[model samples]
Target: MIRAVAFDIGETLVCDDRHWSSWADWLGVPRHTLSALVGAMVAQGRDNAEAIRLLRPGIDLAAEYEAREIAGRGERLEESDLYPDVRPALTALHDLGLRVLVAGNQTVRAAQLLRELNLPAEAIATSGEWRTAKPAPAFFARVVELSGVAPHQIVYVGDHPANDIIPAKAAGMHAALIRRGPWGYLWADDPVGAAADWRIDSLAELPALLEQHRGEAG
Candidate 1:
């Protein structure tokens, strides 16, 4: 049976387009430019922050994150920031006695924002805090460690075919592909997605997925 459920925060639980647009404004580039940079970064198989560093050599990422965290602390995240299916799905999973957690490639400030949202996660962590990002085995390993279960007993859900699904599977965790975001739809047809344990359009579909998997495993 699946004992734990882990998620990628961006585009999975929360829509990150607004944050990317804000980054565009901060970088003094048109929002479309930032959006293009994101697509380019994904197309080239590069990390977003690394792409920014290469694209704009003088931008201070750390300082920008600090400013975001400061503003985030004072602001309350609205329900609109979350996917419509998130709360109900999380509640269903939690009531099913599964552990829920987030392992995301976000800034320290992002973690702070997550806490303020009162999500059903037992723990929410970011690469900035873990000092490693997804696609790195260490990040998935850490998630398994946090889950307190064997890798095979965990289901890791995310939008990125390469970063989230494939790597989680590589680490021996069952992977779920949620097709709702840039990476999700962008990477949908990748051969890697074919290896996912589940391909779902909404979090609302997850509870039944768990039941189906459990029955098959049983």
Candidate 2:
């Protein structure tokens, strides 16, 4: 029985385009330049951080990421930052008596962002807080721990096939791939994504999916 739902924040609940574009503006680069680099890296099945290093050789990636996070904090995320379907889906799940958690490979401020946005989640867990990032099994384990549910009883929904779906399934959680974010539409046909228990175009479909799961579990 699925008793919990854990969502990934970046590109899952919130589109990260604004954050990336803001970083580009702050760094004095054309928005498309940053977009192109990250897109090229994703296309080649490479890490986006590789593009950051390629654009400015010898730049400190961690320090730069942190700097970007700090600058964005001056004007934190708002409800407008979330996907339209996010609150609806999260609310529906909670109303169904399921625990809902929002987890992400993000700075600690991400938790604060969700809190400020009034997202419908029991808890917000960040990679920074856990000190482990996704695509790592331990990260999923921590998600399971925070959810207060066993892996098999949790459903993890996200956009990244490599970072979200694959690892969640490996950790024994059902994976749902939503085809909206950077990797989502591109990876729809990926073997790992296809292997997911559910693949939908939007979180608008999530409530029905949860009902179906509950039906079978019942």
Candidate 3:
């Protein structure tokens, strides 16, 4: 039985339109250009940051991020950025007596913004804070550490199969592939998504699904 549910940030809990748009503006390119490049990279199973590198070769992403922050165009997260189902789903999970955590491949500032939103979660964390990113065993190990539970007692939910579902399962947790974001939709029907123990279209569906799992377990 799953005792906790952990979530990814982008495309799983929040929409990334503002993120990419801000980058496009920073690079002085049309949003569509950067968006297209990102889509192409996703389709080709390449790193999304490769899109930025392709646009301006040898660009130091870390420096650019600091520059953007200095320019007051850094990562921003508002309640409006959250999907409509987020609050209701998280609340429902909490009501079901499950610990809910938000741990994703996001910046430390993004983690701060999420806390400001006052979402119903036990804790919120990011790859930037941990200095570890997903698809890496160390990242999931950190997650297991943060969860304060055995890996098998946790459910990792996200839109990315390679980063979230596949790796989470390999780490001994159940994985839920949520089909909402670009990565989610694109990979939903792919064989790789089959690795997810659960495939859901909305967070609102999670409470019921997990309850069903509980029933089956009992």
Per-model TM-score, in order, reads: 0.90, 0.94, 0.98
Which candidate order results from sorting by lDDT in descending order?
Answer: 3, 2, 1
Winner on lDDT (2 vs 3)? 3
Task: Encode model 2's per-residue lDDT on 1-218: one tens digit a residue.
Answer: 89999999888898887877876786678999999988988888898877667768899967776776676534367777888989888898898899999998987767777787777789998998889998989899999999988999999999889899999999999999999877898897889678778999988798888888889889
Query: How big is the positional error of residue 112 in model 1, measured in Å on the Cα after superposition?
Result: 1.4
Best by lDDT: 3
Backbone clash numbers for all candidates listed = 0, 0, 0
CA shift of 87, model 3, Å: 0.6
RMSD of 3: 0.7
Cα-based lDDT at residue 197, candidate 2: 85
Per-residue CA lDDT of model 1 for 67-159, tens digit only, reads 765876322356788988998999899988899998888877678878888988798999989999888999998998899999999999999
Total clashes for model 1: 0
Q: CA lDDT of 158 in candidate 1?
A: 93
